[model samples]
Target: MVEVEAAGLIAIGAGIAVGLTGLGAGIGEQSIGAAAIGAMAEDPKFFGKGLLMTVIPESIVIFGLVVALILLFVF
Candidate 1:
């Protein structure tokens, strides 16, 4: 019984880890994407840099997923 409860808690923790990070990344990406678009508008040459900047926030979500997996599988 105790082990079952522990497992449940771990699942919850993992879900929170992934969920919050994804939300945060989404919010971050929104702003970055807008700025990237604006920058691109001013100078067409900014496209590469703008795209790179816009994609950077997505890595946060990947990190979150890794954490969640670790939580679920480890300890």
Candidate 2:
């Protein structure tokens, strides 16, 4: 019989923790980049607002990272 170690389980979860965030981030950036470019195509004046709004999705990734970090230290 084989026994599972807590550390190994925690390590696996940590890896997931690290990877899961980038999905939404990538989606966010794609939309933002596309929108920003579209806005630019229409009118260059939206450059600032478009760029700022595009990066708003970055918060999700950052929050995930913080949670992962906390988990890493927790277990």
* After superposition, candidate 2 runs with Cα above 4 Å error: 1-4
Report the lDDT tens digits of candidate 1 across residue range 1-75: 999999999999989988999999999999999999999999999999999999898898899899999998887
* Clashes (candidate 1): 0
Question: Taking the tens digit of each residue's C-alpha lDDT, what string does model 2 give over 1-75?
Answer: 133576677667767866787787888789788989899889999999888988888887888777778767875
Cα error, residue 37 of model 2, in Å, equals 1.1
The worst-scoring run of ten residues by lDDT in candidate 2 lies at 1-10
Please give the TM-score that candidate 2 achieves against the real structure. 0.78
Local lDDT at 10 for model 2: 65
In angstroms, the error of model 1 at 36 is 0.4
Model 2 global lDDT (CA atoms, 0 to 1): 0.80
Q: Best by lDDT, which number?
A: 1
